[model samples]
Target: MAAEETGLRVQEALDRLTGTGAREAGEDLVRELMAFYGEGLAALVGAVAPEALVPALDRPAAAGLLVLHDLHPEDVGTRIVRALDSLPRTPPVLVGHDPDSGTLTLRRAESGGGCGCGGDDEREVENAIACHAPEVTAIVWEQAPALLQIGSRPPTAAEAR
Candidate 1:
């Protein structure tokens, strides 16, 4: 589905979950469906965001999903969780892969949690980490062996759209 359409669906799901004049879908049901859609959207955005940078940088590998590296292990995990949890009712999914171990870990955003409600305040730290980290990789959405030595740039209008 298109990003706008998917966003609408998420809003509808939120409305239903909150009983805000939406058809009486159960909260649990809405949450489940919203979670699914949000995760998919997150993956799509993750994949596309980096592509917009490739043309500007003249690097093929730069056109992939952004990943945080060189962070303290605990910091990496916390930031991942925090990023996921900051989404609205339809929170995004975070999938992290460790290439050396060939391990992939999946995490869901925590509903109604601390990080989910703070908006820009919470994002400040995340933005900082993304800014200061030079060892990060931009992995292709679903492919592993993350591209090394590539950096993340701010999302462009096309990518944000």
Candidate 2:
């Protein structure tokens, strides 16, 4: 069957299951299929040369698949770093990661001009992380500190030489 046809069939099945229990059962079936495919993916990963897989990490969809199945050889930190490096704008510096809480801490890049709040930049970063490292449940942003200037007294008219 075509991919679209398969998707439609799945949606039709989901639609038919109206009750909570039936819906849960359908979701469970999907999860089972996902696990089955994940195993197949693991086997495929094992068959392929490790170097060949490295290139796939650069592509978002492929990388997400690899990460989803936990078949990507690289560690989470390495993948997170790769995601950050791929950012179009100045990438944030990784402050730390708490695996227990699945929290990632990052220091936002300082902008030469503009508010530097980085609302859009943060979203991009989050999207990249989701693609590469879905295991990160939360992101903590560390805003850049304000610049401080030393106080200086202007020379008064009487003090002028």
Candidate 3:
């Protein structure tokens, strides 16, 4: 089944429990299942060679699950880069990521004049990063340096005379 269908089914099951006054029990059951599956995923990751898992990442469902379980072979940075690269529009340059603070700093794409506005673009970036690297809790923008202009120096007083 597709991921969406599976998610809807899970929601329906939860709702059915909620309607029957067993919401807490249903949630607990879900948590237990998640723990069980997480252990399985962890074991699979340990047994398989890292390169063997790379092919699975091509499928969004598999990639998401690996990330959700924190069992993806790639590091957070690699995931972030992959996310950015997947974007249709020009992607920002990654300045740095601070794992301690869960902050990712990025410089806006300097080309195409950058739209000079960020409402839609910012949300898209956030969504992409969150989907790929949920570990990143914050996204920070790094301001590009101001442009410099070159001009002739002023003549000395003696030269002016």
Candidate 4:
């Protein structure tokens, strides 16, 4: 099974167990741990000049970690541009963004030729967005690129009805 699928299953099981007064307690523990680690991360980040933090946040894993700790210094849009630029090939065109809803849409370039990316591309893109642009709650495809146009050339005006 995919790692994502396994993680989702574990989350579901955890949610089930939380129904018996365990949710609040579990949340308290997680909050305490997060507070502890987040403070340390914030201190380390704060020690460095703001400009110096870019290099550290540019790394995907590091970015995710800092974002989780709420220590990332960049805003969502900048992080998104950084994430999109990280993709191997030509990045898609961002069509629209709804800040209120955290919905972003992008259009695949036709030159991509129906990439072999499968579904992993979506998850990877989403994960990247979450790390840098957590405010973007969802990614939507504005258009799927076409490999070819089916219609032949249009006939001259004489054929018009």
Off by over 4 Å in 3: 1-23, 43-47, 151-161
**Which sequence of candidate numbers ranks them by TM-score, best first?**
2, 3, 4, 1
Give me the runs in candidate 1 sitting further than 4 Å from their true place. 1-73, 99-136, 143-161
- Evaluate residue 12 in candidate 1 and report its C-alpha lDDT on the 0 to 100 scale: 66
For 1-161, candidate 4 gives per-residue lDDT tens digits of 34465455556656755578577656655655566667767888889888887777778778887878777777777778888788776676777778999999987644626654447677767776776778888888876654576887798898875
lDDT of 2: 0.85
Candidate 3 residue pairs that clash:
none
Q: What lDDT score belongs to each candidate, Candidate 1 first?
A: 0.44, 0.85, 0.82, 0.73
State the local distance difference test value for candidate 4: 0.73
Global CA lDDT of candidate 1, please? Answer: 0.44
List, residue by residue over 9-47, the lDDT tens digit for candidate 3: 567666677565577758755865676678778888999
Candidate 4, superposed: residue stretches over 4 Å from native:
1-22, 115-118, 144-161
Give the C-alpha miss distance for residue 57 in model 2, angstroms. Answer: 0.4
Candidate numbers, best lDDT first, in rank order? 2, 3, 4, 1
Clashes of 1: 0
* Index of the highest-TM-score prediction: 2
What are the models' TM-scores? 0.21, 0.78, 0.71, 0.68
Per-residue lDDT of 12 in model 4:
60
Instruction: Tell me how far the alpha carbon of residue 60 in candidate 4 is from the true structure, in angstroms, after superposition.
Output: 2.6
Estimate, for each residue in 3-59, the C-alpha lDDT of model 2 and write its tens digit.
Answer: 465566567657757865687758765865676678777888999999989888989
RMSD of 1: 22.0
